[model samples]
Target chain A: MVFQSWSYVGFLLITILVVRLTSASWRWLPLLLASLFFYSLTHWGAFVILLFSIFYTYFTAIRVSGSAHMSIRYRWLLLSIIGQVLILGVFKYLGFFNGVMQGVYALLHKGDWNDWPLLVLPLGISFFTFQSMGYVFDVYYKIRKPEMHLGKYALFVSFFPQIQSGPIGRSKEMMPQWTSISLPSFEQYRWAIQLFVWGLLKKFVVADRLGNYVDEAYDTVGSMGTWVWLFILVLYTVQLYADFSAYSDMAIASARMLGIHIPENFAFPYKANNITDFWRRWHLSLSGWLRDYIYTPLLFSKKKWKKWAVVYAIGITFVICGIWHGASMTFVWFGVVQAMILICEMFTKDRRLVWAEQWGRTYQWASVVLTFWVISFCFILFRADDMYQVAGVLADMGQWNSSLLTTYLAEKNISRLMGILFLLTMFLWGDERWDRWIKQPQMSMNKSVLAISLMLTVLMVLGVFGKNDFIYFQF
Target chain B: MSNEELTARVYGVFRKVFKNEGISVHRETTAKDIAGWDSITHLDIISGMEEEFDVEITGFEVMNMSNVGDLYDLLTQKLAE
Candidate 1:
């Protein structure tokens, strides 16, 4: 069931009520069952697959522990990673890979292999697969031991709130939270409710509203002007943040209702002065996971590099990360551009500001203008249908060199510029001070309760009334 | 270098790389064993060791060196030659 579903909401309400009514283990038992029921609503068959994955890895880990030699241990570790990736590839990327291979084969006159049945994309397969694999890999590396208990392990993988979209909680982070059988405190409830409300505002009011313009511009297929495509792409940066962060905000808040404290998933991503800062802020859990598992391993594995080599690894990892999102050329180029910009920054150090300073006031302001435009230009790839569309969009953007500023987009779309401004300001403002604002301590229980109640009321009116799914669900 | 000298130098590298001067060093300590040590900070430590000692490290050794003692042994063997 969707977090936004009426049945789910009703179930959750009953859950909150029952938790308040009971104590200790008795309280969480029904909640755990309810969580399973929530997961089963999506695809019961796939849920069985999920259960099998959990069981497979759990047993595989225990079995691997029985092995004697380091080579045996390494074999088991390799098998575990290979099994999980193969499962992910079949469920998530078989179609993706097939599509690519067909095109490549057709070009070579080997003909397309079109006989295979389309693979059904499993919901939350990416998330749960990663979680299970992380368990085995960590055990193999001896970073952490496998949990002897099955129930807590199951709860870790299928924690319904996180099973869908994740802050990609590590075994180290979430395992401790699962150990508890406690009640949600009043403060936790208040903060959870506040986070839920803010998340709703982001998803429904902001994201759904922005989706209207983006959909309109991009839906026309190949006829869309180059400038218009670029416009939608920049707006996507806004859409993506709203979609994913909203999911994370809700996930964290929902976990909080169960007396589980989850980590914060987003920082102020757009306000990032550099791509490095962007990684620091954006989809933090996934980024952190990639760093620990992917980037660091690759970086340290390579021999020591000259100054340029450090920058090269930074560029390479970002590009690889970008391609992992999709096989599209747009994604590839966008990733490379972002990495290149970041590499450029590594060489500049404080010299960037120094150059601006030496160039005086007009040049400094011009630099800021240049910086913002360049970043926006890179975002064009993320928004386009393909690289061909990106070319068309970039070409259209160039044509506006002599046109009036007011003609940047259609008349109706022009109204949405206010939203763009709002998004930009909020993002820039969020970086330095939004966390400080939200974390401001409330004075009393009653005041916190009242504030949360009012915020939930607003969310009920604005957020829950819509039919939109959380944007990060697809990713 | 003796194990004790190697241990102290590796500990110094750890403390400096992680930027926590007050960290107590021990042979059994992993990255998580130390308070406030994280992946990014650990990379800083590895990077610092490479530059300071002028010795190259394999990715295999980096991954396997979970504790202070593991690093100390690896450094001692490399520095010996």
Candidate 2:
């Protein structure tokens, strides 16, 4: 189930209550059952898809582990990754791919557009597929041992909090936690509540409000002026972050509440100085999963041809990543632009090092900011509906007449922009830096704790706009 | 090759890959210690070391490789056995 859904949360609360009363060993079962119910609720017919992944990977690992025949074991691993990816393609990309193929065929005058029809995308298909593939790839590399138990493996893939737009957990980070039964500790509950409230604020107070502008602007990009275009670009930056990260924070918080600790998926990504650094922080789980499986394996393509390998690695990984975002050309372009930047960063590393050393930290920060703006501008392509709209937005960005500012920046727009700026700055800034209280207990205060708790209560009451799914879910 | 020569060759490979001057051969040096030692250069260094030392690296070896010393040990074992 999507982490924000009340049904999933309700089931989770009941499971936590049961675990609090019962032994820890049995806690895993209730959550596992809840997770199954959660998945079934969304796409009961496709529950078999997750089951197929689990059984395919589990048995493959069991059969392949420490096997004498290396090629045979590797073939199993390849077959598993390929199989899961094919399933992911069917569920996630069938419609978009078919549409695109039809368009391409129409352009070529080889076939009629009516030949291909769109298909319904199964819920959580992208995330669970990636998680399962990562698990199987980890086993193939022999970095992690296969989980012998089928139920546990299923739980690992279908864990409710991360079943939707994910902090996609790897076998190494999550499976052990999956096997453990959590106790309902007060500390965990406190943090969970705090995180959940903050996420609620992000989604309702920030993302939804910003969406009011971005939604309209994107829906009709042709009439939009430069100010409107710029505003939407900035708004999209915030909307996407808040929408996805709020979901992430809620997932982490929900999992924490159940005494299951999930990883932090966002890390003040706006503060990132470079595209590479931005990537390092943004959608951290997926990037990391890509790194571990796609990028690292591509590194092993060959030794003597390693330069080509690096180029190929970055190129292919991002292609996979791009397509993973959706069955769309925009997402593909986004991935391509990111890959190009990464490659340039690699190629110019020596010069950059020399420059950084001579320029100092502030200059480095400025450079990173410039890089972020360039990346942000590229995201305009992503925000646009099609090539025509993309061209229109680009023209708007370039056509800066100071005279148009007064007409476009109405008082309402100004207030919205200011509010967005404030929220985004707060979101981008590092949370609660322990700047020199390193020796001391940094977060010390029982009195302030009450104040914090009260703030959370207020935030939750004020913040939830209610029932918005994560933006990435559509992809 | 002796462990010392292997270490020297690997160090040379890293120096060449990273394009950093005055890099000294040491078993303790890590990727973190060198400027421009990102994943891209990492592959270059590993590939160069593999070619120079004429030993294949398992993905496991690449995963666990931390410091230059680990490379030395892996190289030694691969060459000797």
Candidate 3:
């Protein structure tokens, strides 16, 4: 059922055809059924959990909006959010908490504690929970009205294109689109196909090719030299962005073919000159959700704390962001590192602005390079399985062995690796140029067809079709 | 205060918080329209508005404000109260 597969292609085509043939008012019926069918294919148990979440959030939202008293509305909002958090905690963090307890027992030299049986993490549990909880929050704040239709609400929560990994749709944006689904026009379909093909090039050709090297380096981190570690750090960052954003592009394109628009997830994040700018551009939807729901409330509630409130908000928000990623300490550290950098940036904002004015282009270029390295180093925590592996990787960085670099260079696939890197560079360059051209109204259909054809050819020739699951699927 | 007076005061708060005396905001002005108006500086603006108008703004009201017009409306209601 993965979007990258041929079977998914057939499923999407059939679903689109059926929806198009269905009456306008009833288009949602086929889409809802298809989305549920898609989820059910993942796991029946997880599907049941998703259904429960939809029902619980749906009913809770209605109750919140229905309540006349502020206290009552607050209570319901708190109850619903806690319920969602508890569900996420059990499914996603039980093992993490259990490991902490085991460490305590081992420290006391007691008998080994039995391991807890971890539940299967439903795919995209984090995404759906956050999305649904955001809906409830909006209702409480009166940002948007609660959708009274149960089926439409269910489709909003479980929409197949975004359910697995999201550009996390808001109810206000997505609910209205469902009530009036229509077939995409010829131009729209052409653009969507071009988008999908481009995503395929990124995922199959660039990401997977790079993933090969990243995996091999991490697999033998203890034996790697500094040069190998450097490559690992940089390559893993690229691999992650390519893999996750590729998924988003395809998901958006799939939804676009149905004339539904999801939010853009990435915006040339690597071009950002600072950590703050990077967050604004990277994983835009999730960051928006966090800012609106978590950070804003936390900061406003403690506005009297002044600058400390910003620090506190950044710290707490990113810790939650980290835990939202997984039940691992590595992820927590990842969040902590980002929060620390952001806090530093906030305090030094004025100083940096003055430096930007003084140093001009050189300062901006230096800032971008520094920010990229900072992010790449932080991603080491993201990529490592455990602290021990992270330690091993860092320790390997001190081994300055030129012979190892020479051996790596002499590997048989070096030419292919270089070719993939070239393609990756070209893709990034083309993306910037495409953004500039897309805003202009004179874009020709012939150009789109040619671009799509070229991308498909490149994908066929170079794509590593090992059926790699998108990296974000686990989160 | 009149609506125009309230808007002018709001613009003053924006200028003070962002440290740009020449900054201009319209009814449609959003965070994107200003250089330093982001999530980090947003609280400063809210606090600045509160200080300027002597009104307490809730998170609910803040969340509802999408543009300067919405903020002007919120301030008008708060001032009326």
Question: Highest lDDT, which number?
Answer: 3
Q: What is candidate 1's lDDT per residue for A361-452, written digit by digit as tens?
A: 77655654565456667766776778777766656555544233345455656656875667656754563464444445453667666656
lDDT of 3 by residue, A1-475 (tens): 8989889999999999998899877888898999999999999989999999999999999999998999999999999999999999888888998999899899999978888889978999999999999999999989999999999999999999999999898988899998888788887887778778778888998788788888888887777689878877888888898888889989999998877888889998888899999999999989999999999989888888889999999999999999888889999999999999999999999999999999999999999889888999999999899999999988898899988877877883688668766876776557667544432334488887678778789889888889569989889
Candidate chain B TM-scores, in order: 0.81, 0.87, 0.92
lDDT of 2 by residue, A178-230 (tens): 55666755655765666675676667766777777777777765555666677
User: Model 1 off-target regions past 4 Å?
Assistant: A17-32, A221-231, A304-316, A327-329, A332-334, A347-375, A401-410, A413-435, A441-467, B1-81
The true-versus-predicted C-alpha distance at residue A77 of model 3, in Å, is 0.6
- The per-residue C-alpha lDDT of model 2 at residue A338 equals 83
Ranking by TM-score: 3, 2, 1
lDDT of 1 by residue, B1-81 (tens): 676766677768877866678778787877657754644456677778877788877765776676877877788788988
Question: Total backbone clashes of model 1?
Answer: 1
Candidate 3 has an lDDT of 0.88
Which prediction has more favorable TM-score, 2 or 3? 3
Each candidate's DockQ score against the native complex? 0.33, 0.43, 0.75
**CA lDDT, candidate 1, residue A97:** 72
The estimated TM-scores of all candidates read: 0.82, 0.89, 0.97
Report clash pairs, candidate 3: none
Best model number under TM-score: 3
Cα-based lDDT for every prediction: 0.70, 0.73, 0.88
